[model samples]
Target: MKDYTIHRGVDYRVYESEPTTFYAKCTQYGAGCDWLIRVTKMSRKFCWEIRKYNGSHTCTRATISQDHSKLDSNTVAEAIKPLVEVDPSIRVKSVIAKVQAKFNYTISYRKAWLAKQKAVESIFSGDDLVPNIRVLHRVFWSYYPCIRAFRHCKPIVQVDGTHLYGKYKGCLLVAVSQDGNNNIVLIAFAIVEGETSEAWHFFLSNLRQHVVTRDGVGLISDRHDSIRAAIARSNGAWSPPRAFHMFCIRHIESNFLRKFKAPYLQKLIVNIGYSRTVREYETRYQRLRERVEANTNWLDRILREQYALAFDGGYRWGYMTTNLVECINSVLKGARNLPVTALVKATFYRLNELFTRKRAEAEARINAGHVFSELVTSKLHANQRAAGNIQVSCFD
Candidate 1:
């Protein structure tokens, strides 16, 4: 019997029992030869056939051929030479072209070029991110930072939801954080069918599972009714462990605007956001109410009812804003119209690109020995220090 090697650029092992079956195996390209091949004779005139010890199918007899010669390792190697050099990239490009041709009539060349460019840019960005397993793991860690088991540290969680458009048209809930330097960091994300209380609950539950501590960590989100309901459901001695939840004031003001349309009241409500005390808020609210009454009593009622609901201290989370989620939503805008798999892949690619840019910026800053805060201050104030008599702290 004689043995032959099967090669298709990728490594593969092949064996045959007899010369005839070996010839058939070579002819079928290993497609029909599943069992080991055993060589019986390798004399001046080699003769061979194949048999399956495990009862696997044998190669077709008609596919076999014979050439009288001594079969050796060299002969088998020679037989496999041409098959090893097939270029996989050429085959891949051919397949891509064929697929593209099908849509050629519907899409213009310029549009096709743009699509290909977008796909490549999305995949090869500097973020050390890829569409496969690596990026998947990165995404998991980004939005779920609590996965890292720090011995004793407060978990910072920021939650917000955004709408996505596509075949499934839904909302994506994202949780993120801020580093000591105040840079936004992603934590975890969930794609839900809708922004209902049930959806928010499911997202929060899944998010909770990824974190180490829930007690001291703070969970921040917009003042959405669904979110409030989810938090309410989380109450009780038997409740899922609670994170000190806070609501973003921006969402509250937007809700107020939607309910109360009086222009003067709208201005007053904006002022309430800048108020330092409850007295200031009440004073502004009354003035706004009187102004609304002068125009229309019905508007006053609507504004008062909405203000009562929004200002309930239970819902406000300091001056926390929804900008982080909004940033992510903007990054996802283009890819939201894709299929689920495509959407996931595109998001990772885009995020990787973002982090890659961030890493580069950080490296550049380090290389220049430039403190980021100083740079920010210089850029904002053109390097002019505030008057000594009236020192200004930016945070204030």
Candidate 2:
């Protein structure tokens, strides 16, 4: 009836709107137009049936307004869905123009804006917003293939959070891993209100419950207090036999630089954390100590097992930093500028591209009669050549 009234350019006024009856009549009820309709629900059929119908509208419009009550926000929302899907950032003015073009009527700024909001929500499913948020429903996601690939890869996971840059607010948290061939696989993701402890707790809980299931997994990240607090509340899910938490050396270097304002000692700071043995660690520590004892107090606050490779029980896998997760952030840099739903879709397609290309390359190598990945095959051949130079001594 709303569509019919809008199309026919007729005015209507409802006298009775009830569950059992609907009565509408021409707005010029007494002048000359006798157009009216009364519909009632048949109790037996439970369906609407027209009980009375008068003659066609015999009156024309007295005045035309800039808006139509029949063309409300919900109606306009359905009309502009295609436009919203193509460009979520389309302006409110564009929405008004679209309504003018399609409906032949101009809508108010508030109505056009409301229509666009509805279109975006219907298309993208909306996002969990952050700034000045009162109620939050967090969404944490992990692709199935990526989660399934974790057991086949090395027991290491690097996690990080990057800030979104466009119309949407909040931080994008990602948990990434690598296969034997050093292919970066993004396993899990979430959007949260900055790097708060509660947010990290939500992300990590979903990651552990669904993706990071294997034992002795190495969890690498910066020493953010929120991350530490979240770990402390994990009930040993991220500790000891289950997993080991380690700090990134790059962040340590940045912290040291920030505190002491010394660039010359940054290399030494990295080398100390990169050291694979006690002697190497001591050598690097002494070198830093000799060069500058000036205001470098974070050195005294170091943890060997968390940052130093010499004491990390081989779980670091020779990785001294969260550079891998930073690389993932770089890959998603452009996506950060998109709306929340588009950003998530971008990640899905991005991971699909990576997986598709890598799978093809791996299959090609195997079909060419290689039993291992290119990295493993290269190491095996290098080992074979080195074995000819070895001389065994049998003195027993």
lDDT scores in order: 0.50, 0.85
Model 2 clash pairs are none
Predicted candidate 1 versus true structure: per-residue lDDT over 83-127, tens digit per residue: 212211112233234323432212233433344334333333424
Candidate 2 matches the true fold with a TM-score of: 0.61
TM-score for each predicted model, relative to the true structure = 0.48, 0.61
lDDT string, candidate 2, 117-204, tens digits? 7877777764545477565457799889898888898999999999988667889999999999888888999988799999999999
